[model samples]
Target: MNHYDSIVIGAGHNGLVCATYLAQGGQRVLVLEAADTPGGLAAGREFHPGFHASVAHSVNHFSAKVASDLNLAAHGFEAGADGHSIVGLGTDGAHVVAGAGALHNASDKDTAAYDEYSALLGRFAKALEPSWFRTMPRIGSLAVGDLMTFARMGLKLRLLGKKDLQEFMRVASLPARDIMDEYFEDETLKAALSWDGLIGSRMAPRSPNSAVLAMLYRMSGQAASVKELVNSLSGAATASGAEIRTGAPVKRVVINGDENGLGVGGVELASGEQITADRVISGADPQTTFLNLVGVEHFDIGFTNRIRRLRCNGLVAKLHLALDGLPEFEGLDRPGGRMIIAPSMDAIEFAFDDAKYGQCSSDPVMEVTVPSLDDDTLAPAGQHVLSAHVMYVPYELKGGWTDAARDGIRERAIDTIARYAPGIRDRILHSEFLTPADLERDYRVTGGHWHHTEFAMDQLLMMRPTYGAAQYSTPIPGLYLCSAGSHPGGDMVGAAGHNAAQEILR
Candidate 1:
């Protein structure tokens, strides 16, 4: 039996980040991944001949602190420049471009309103930024460290001054629709601005409580390509003396019982090899880690139920198109930057309404990115890859995900895009459509949720993945969580992994 100080399951970016930190702290760490490569959803795969795409197409808010601490640039990952524009496509060749502190192609009133909106949100995002990197204070904890964390959080908000603090309180819980309506008039611009807040979860523009917080969470960092970020993290982890083994899926986390109750012994691989370790840190989603990997026999009834009841059925699907050449948009010279394809907030809401009943959205909305223009490696010379996040595609489709259903949604997505770029259909060399169920089966994520869990108010901060295990430490001794399902929630941010390592090392 091989033995080590810790065994980190899954080589997703977070797992690699955790392993890197632990190894740097002088612990013998081994990372095991079911996938043949690292990066989890961020792993680039060849979908068609000479064309590649990753499920997670871009990194908008990956932690700069994690990159700096791991020296990721030395390993070939540099954060892209800030202010990449987000384009809202209009059917009649009118589009709105947002970023760099300006809103172009919008009404003078809206453009002026945008500046004030940006400044207010910027201040709020800045105040809340530190909390994402730090371990959230556990509720009802009197520990000096925990208390200080709370104090610092309160102090940061108070420092925003009387009026801004009041505004933050008022706006943080408003639905994305309300916030957008308060500042913008153009429907395209409103929907485009709300995209960041509502993506990757079971949320629409009108879903209140956490959308604004989600947007602010995303506002902290610049964008980077997933391929570079993953490669860099993998390089840094291995360089720090962590051994990562791919294609090794853990069947179960071995448990042993004693007077001190149950604890992790190590893990049993699907191949039947059992390796011993002092600790086991799972990078899988909470339900998969506890209910599937660890087994329900070890957990109390209440905790098991909570894990099962987690609202994690993903509503987003990924669409990847291999184009023979760049498809020109009706209005734009080139489809540069992140483009959004929802005409209005009502369009998004109607899609969400269809999905709420377990049906695929009849009129789906999406965020489109032509990544190959910036990275030539994604496609053949002069060719391109169209990567899109198609939303309101239910994991539990009305009739379940069938070949017919998948094809229907795929065609719908293509048709929606074609409305803006008429030449897109002819340019398609191949298409890869992955529904949420496909993401679950292929990526090993529960419900195919990119965040592993829903990024809602009840499922965030101290209550994330539920109370007993919210701080990374679980009820089972020597077992910890380092996945996006932990503390600061998802999106390639790396804070969960970073915070988990700090807890383990402390």
Candidate 2:
């Protein structure tokens, strides 16, 4: 067997980030990817003869540490100044466009409330930001580092000075609907803000803490396509002498036995090739890494059951359209950036209600962006690509996602947009639709969940994934989890990967 110091399975952004950091720490690292390319969902592809769409769209939550640590900008990762501004569409053709410093077409009350709400949330998010970069302390460990880490967190909250601290604690677990009701009266503004907490999440906006945790975690980073970002990490890893192999799907993580318990010895490829490494880190989800790759026989029943209980059913569907031309919105001069189609908080929650009973929403909430409007290289001349991250479409549909069901969901999405932007349907030259099932088939992500698991309060911080394995280390020696499933949940942030690498280096 070919041998190395460490082996990382998968080439998702987090996996690549882990490999980069490991290699930088002087470990002989090897990254094995199942796909033919490196970017995983971050890579763009052509579905039509001339039009292309990114596998994943929307870029408002990537970590700066990953970029700076990997020196991605120097390696061709361009950060566009064009940040995401939301345009909330109303049912009767009314709209509100909100940017960093301004809220267009809103009443004075809502506009002022928007500024105050954003600033207060920004402060809380900044305070919580440090926790994203570090691994959570192991449960029951009395180590000084762990004690100090916990103390620092407490001090940060205390420093919020009584009133804000009480407010933050009270609202952290409250329903998003309640928060919106208290802060703003504009239905459009409430829906726009509430959508952030439930995007790609299985939770409804009204679920307790769903709004605060989801939106706060999302606000933790900037959003952008990380194709160049991946390239930069890959380049740095290689420069540090790491080996990355595309199309090398790992069959299983190989374990060897000794007098003591078992440990990860290496990995076996689908082609029957075997490679050995001292440590094996999986950037795949816990289910994929533990049950599928490692096999349940090696673990205790308790551990296997915990992995099985992971909440990973994905509720979002992705839709892309190759437009003949840019479609005009009712009130917007431009159609790029993040545009929301949820008319009210009630509408957003009602969409989730359908999925609760295993049905696709007739009216769904969607986060939309026309990347071609900003990045012209994505489409051919005189054409544009519309990528919509649609929600409330269950992975397990009412009767399964049959051909007609797929078409039904597709039309509903397009029609929903048409209600806000007329002539959108006429401009479509081609379209590609992906249910969670399609995402799983194409990306090999378990449950087609982009974040590996739901980012609920139970699956975050010290209890993330589980209590015993929250610090990246698994029960099996030499095996660790570096996926979004581990900590900080998901959203293209590389904190989990960066923190996992830190644990291994230590």
Candidate 3:
């Protein structure tokens, strides 16, 4: 019988952000997290006795506005340049290093092309950046505010000038492979450049529609550790007077059916403790929120069908290795940056081809980061922790995820890494590989999608999580969505939560 102004289920970064904003707006907010700790996918966990890693090991593209608004720097949040460079590892010890607007160890033509590519994309990303944080106006809405949103978007693109605007239009929907081919001659650098576009979602270099957009989306923001980002957000939320309770699993969203139709009463805990609130904001994925927690009966047939049809099966997996010592790549003195294992666009495409058929890629491509290089606290003094985002590992394997199957993929990942770092196998003290299924179970995100759902054209912007729910407010009264499933999709970015809070406050 405890009552509050709002109840946010799941203490993911988005949820924490929404709670902080709402609390700051003078609402009595309570955030409930099923896990014993907050941070959702970004939460740090100790897989081994002395090593720590999160599903999302690195922070890229977290909202600077959100950080500044929350005064996160005061809470120990650092968002600036991700000091580490990105190195595209070559088989023959010829690596291509990408820095701000420059590429090292590439052909002269390719190097010059990279500068133009960076400048053009940088302009395009800057133009589109505001849309990511704004509430995407509902498609076909005649509301003046919605029309103004459209006008602002069009103006941003227009401000890019006729030539750049035309170029943006032409390149915006091009496949990652096509763009890379157009920009660079070095296959390794092309593959590395395209990796950002296809990293989390079910996409490859050749896959068209929104890959370039995804790349542009990630082009903004600096890198911070997941621990720092989550901790600061949690601290800010609590400091702003939002109460967060971990280990409180919501059994279901309590629904009240009156003449006005179905509405959220609050949430009932797994322990059968029902809490009351004026509104309930879900930080869980769409399917889990609707089918599992809210129940299908509360929604109409169309809404239910759309929610069910959402393509949320995650294709990415996480690999964490506890190394006895630092891993030395063939070309580099120290593995101090984000190292990409993909050799070419074809390599990425082939990996995707296998995964789309319910098989783990024989040659998996991954982005490896030795966070301990920047922060010694990740591992013991001499030891190190290696984290990688393994691509094309399907949620539903050929025969489902067996211990042998998991081990098979895990070995393949380590073997893939060992190719770049010849002595990496010898350095490994312990290894943990999490498939999409494992991610789903452990992170409480349906399909284990880091974005909660696919970031494809159909599931992005105003159409995200489906039409009626895209505005953050759900079809069900007194219920809203503040998770990655909402408009603008996912990332460590808190835009979805910030936008959701704005809508609620409005």
Candidate 4:
């Protein structure tokens, strides 16, 4: 029988990183993944042979500090400058972006305005850097550790004083639209900035506290991002001596019925076999680990029922398209950050509003990325891989996802892309669409919440997942949570996993 020091349930970035760190500490670790491949949502799989498109992950807002500290480059990861997205506002206009150091660029005239806008983004990033060092609690509702983290983090802000607090307050506490409006006069700029505030969130542009996402996003960890971060996952995990099982499915975590409350010491797999360990780390979703697989035999109804009430609406989807040639836009040379496919900010917001009411957005919003323009690894010579990170897909639509419904979405994306790049419809050699249902089943995201749960105020910080569950520990000791479902809610910070690891080892 092969026993291990620690067994991680999922090989997602967070799980892998945690396993790596633990293994590096000299404990034998094993990463068991049900999926054939790793990198869960952050994964990059070739949609068609020789055509690679990154699904689910559309941004590298992953902290740079985390990357530098992890030394991911040593593990083999490289990125290029062109990963930026040029967000267009439906009509022929400039694109607002966050890629590269320049921030944004407009293919249209008015180079001076672009320069000024770009400079402001640089300033914003500077102001955010100091605060990045502070340890932030996981994204959901606050926990005791979160409170302690907040208190410690708050000390770093003494340099900002009261004025900084007041000025920064709007960006974190107000509606995202209002904050973007404060920064840019251009409607396109406003739309682009506001669009991100609600990414992977249940909030809208007008939702209070939605703007915090914008501030938190600029909190780049120094040098780390998507690919680099994933590379770190491999090293930290592999070097830690954790034997990673690429295709093993842990059907359930076996709870030994000891006097210590069935105290989670082992796991069972679909093969009808069990592996005993000193501890079992369920790196999967809390609900999936407890309710779906383990059943109520190991949980109290109050805790299990609360987990059931977790509100997650799988509303986001990613469309990967392979183009024979690079797309040429009307004003610009190629596709960049975001294109206002819905026509206007009103259109985009309306789509989100409809999604709120159990219906799909009529004309959804898209943050398009042309990775071939930046990274050649995605495709063959001169070919392009276009990734469209779409939002406002309803969890339960007017009519659930069907062939017709999915086709409608495809048509919408095509029409939108064509508006910016004429004849783009003809460029597609192959394409793939993943709807909410597909996302839920594939990633086991509990309603496809990439953020794990809703990002509303009620679900943020200490309130996330549950009022106190965000701390990455159950009320019981010797058990821990490590997935995005824990806290600092999402966006690949891996804080939840790191925080949990520290606690278990402490």
lDDT of 1 by residue, 267-385 (tens): 99999999999999999999999999999888889988889989889888999999999989999998888899999999999999999999887789999999898899999999999
TM-scores of the models, in the order given = 0.98, 0.97, 0.98, 0.88
Per-residue error (Å), model 4, residue 37: 1.3
What C-alpha lDDT values do all the predictions have?
Answer: 0.92, 0.84, 0.92, 0.66
Better of 2 and 3 by lDDT: 3
Residue 358, model 1: lDDT of: 90
- Give the per-residue lDDT of model 2 (tens digit) for 1-506: 38888899988888988998988898889999998878677766787888877666766778887888877776676664555888888767677877665788888999888898888777778778888898887778899999888988888878877888888888888888998898888898888888777787777767875568777777766656545566676777677677999999999999999657899899999999999999999988888898889998888889888888988888888899999999888777778668899888888889999989998889988988888877777789889999998888888888788999999999999999998888899999999899998888898888889778878777889877887678998988999999888987777788888999999999
Winner on TM-score between 1 and 4 is 1
Worst 10 residues of 1 by lDDT: 77-86
Regions of candidate 3 where Cα sits further than 4 Å from its true position = none
lDDT of 3 at 304: 96
Quickly count the clashes in candidate 1.
Answer: 0
